[model samples]
Target: MLIGDVARRSGVSARMLRHYESLGLVRPTGRSEAGYREYSSEDIRRIFHIESLRSLGLSLREVGLALDDPGFTPSGLVDDLIRQTRERIAAETELLTRLRRIDAAEPAGWEDVLRTVALLQALGSESAGKRQRAALSSAEEGPVPVEALAEAALSETDPNVAGALRWALARSGDTGLPLLAEGLGSPVAEVRRRAVQSIAEIPGGAATALLRQALTNSDVVVRRSAALALGTRGVANAVPTLIDMIVEGANDVDAADALSALASDPASTDQIATGLVGRLARGDVEASARRRLTQALADIPGTTTSRALADLSNDDDRAVALTATYLLTLRGAQ
Candidate 1:
């Protein structure tokens, strides 16, 4: 076949076919009557091969090596190609995400678009301080999409940056709650904790509801953060987790404070007191845990807590007896 016919038939442009020949990738096996380049069946086949390899993100050099070098092994090259393809896809996906967030911001003009883009770039900056500043400034300029803020809040490791991101998300509104809630289900324990903590900062019935739901999360950290937030919100459902926190001595002081807040509700006072008493009766409750539980009851105003405190005041552990006695004295004075 003539070069023109091969170019037309194989869908390889004439210029590319010529470039392949210049690089010695595919040589014309013969010459036509007009002395033009002629492509034999094998030459045309080679052209098709080069085109096929290029489609997989192979450079022309790699394609040439893949086809001509009998000693070349495809396994290494193929693995490299796979890695390159994944990287390209990840870059494209990140760009798409940035575009979607920019669109969500609803920029009205070029200046708005530029500002939104600058804020997004800053949020993704390698420096935690820059990212934190971006988060703090996000609200002053205007709301970045809550989705962007939620994603940052969930993945951020720097305490200061994460706090700023959570604050920005809270101000952006509960629209980010659904996105943040999804993070609560993440397989990463740190991510789940951050998600629940961020949700806790968001004020609203929806955020409170999410925290109440998170009280039952399998991750202990998630459950504790949710319980603390709910306790402050006066949600009584977090009582069990709050009590567990006291027993475990993980932020037990904060846990005790949350229980006290929950106790302010007349209906939950007995339930909270009774729950505390149940743990105290357990043989498994260590002396330290027992003391923590006893100290937790000081803020409960109900008769159930009073009776439990009275029983604790007579306990064998000297520290427990003293702590309980002091609490009872304070209660009596109140």
Candidate 2:
């Protein structure tokens, strides 16, 4: 076949064929009588081989090595190609994410677009200070997309930066709740904990609903955080988890205060007092937990709580009995 025929049949343009020849990647096995380049069947096959290697992301130089170097092994080269492909894909994905966040910001002009881009870059910066400043400036600079704030809040590791991200999300209201809800399902325990913590700071019935869902999350930290937030919101469902926190001594003081806050509601007072007393009555109640439970009862006012406290005043554990007696005295004086 002549150069034109080879270019037509193989789809490798004549110019590319010449370039391949210059790189020593392919050479015609014959020359026409008229002096034009002519390719034999074997030359056509070699052209196909070069195109195939190039399809696998091999550079012309690598393709030359692959075809000419007897010692050239494809294993290392193939692995390297795979690594490079992955890096390219990661860069593309990051770029796409940035574009999406910028689009979601609905920038009014090039200035808004530039500010949003700068904030996003800072959010991902290696310096914690930059990240925190970005989080703080997000709302001030005209509201970085809520999605960006939610993503930052989920991944932020630095305590101060994380706090700022949470504050930004809270100010954004429940707009970020769905992203945070997805974060609650993350396999990483820390991510789940952060998701619940961020959601807790958002005030709304929607945030409350998400917190209620988080109460049943498989992660204990997530569940604990959700319970504390729910308690502050005056949701009665947190009562059980609050009681559990008291028993296990996990944030027991905060849990107790939450219980006390819940008790301020006339309807929940008896229920709160009863839950605490039931834990105290359990056969497995330890001395410390029982005392914490007794101390927890100090603020609960009701016949149920008073009767329980009076019964606890004569308990066998001296500390428990003293705590109960002290609480009862305070109650009587009231």
Candidate 3:
């Protein structure tokens, strides 16, 4: 076949075929009567092979080595190609994410686009200070997508930066609650903790509802954070977890305070007192935990708490008796 005919049939251009010949990749097996470059069937096949390899991201030099070097094994080269392709894909994916976030901001002009880009880069910066500043400024400037802020809040490890991210997310209202809710289910314990903490900062019925759902989360940290936040929000469902916190000595003081806050509501007063009294009645209630439970009852104003404290005042444990007596004195004074 003539060079033109070979080019037409193989889909390799004439210029490319000549270039391959110059590189000694392929050559015509024989000359035609007109002295035009002629290619045998074998030469045309080699041109097709080179194009096939190039499609796999092989450079011309690598393609030549692959075609000509008998000692070359494809395993290492193929692995390298796989790694390169993965890296390219990862870079493209990150770029796509950035573009999506920027578009979500709905930038009004070139200046807005540039500011959003800068804010995003700063949020991902290695310096905690830069991330903190970015988070603080996010609420003041053109809106950063709530998803971006929520993602940052979940992944942030630095306390200051995490606080700033949470504040920014809170200011965004419950827009990020769904994302944060998903974070509560993350396999990473720290991520689950952060997710609950961030959700606690967001104020609304949606956020409160999410915290209520998190009350049953398997992660202890998530449950505790949710309980504390719910307590402040005047949700009575946090009573059991708060009582458990007191027994376990995990933020027991805060849990007691939450119980007290709940007790302020006349409807919840007896429920809170009953939960505390029930823990006190348990055979497994340790002396210190029993006293803590007694102290927790001091602020609860009801006959149930009064009877429990009165019983505690006569207990054999000196610490429990004295603490209950002191509380009774205060109650009498009130």
Give each model a TM-score.
Answer: 0.92, 0.97, 0.97
Poorly placed runs, candidate 3 (over 4 Å): none
- Superposed model 1: Cα runs more than 4 Å off: none
Ranking by lDDT: 3, 2, 1
Tens digit per residue, CA lDDT, model 2, 1-334: 8999999999999999999999888989888899989899999999999999999999999999999999999999999999999999999999998899899888999999999988988988899999999898788888468998998899989999999999999988788999999999999998898899999999999999999998899998888999999989999999999999999999999999999889989989988988999999998989999999999998788999899988998999999999999988898888
Of 1 and 3, the candidate ranking higher by TM-score = 3
Residue clash pairs of candidate 1: none
Error of 2 at 125 (Å): 1.1
Residue-by-residue lDDT tens digits, candidate 1, 83-197: 9889999999999998999899998887888998999899889999999999999999963767888899999999999999999998898989988889999998888989998
Tell how far residue 57 is off in model 2, in angstroms.
0.5
Q: How much is 81 displaced in model 1, in angstroms?
A: 1.8
lDDT of 2: 0.92
**Which candidate order results from sorting by TM-score in descending order?**
2, 3, 1
Candidate 2 collision pairs: none
Evaluated against the true structure, the overall lDDT of model 3 is: 0.92
Residue 19, model 3, lDDT: 94
Where is model 3 poorest over a 10-residue stretch in terms of lDDT?
141-150
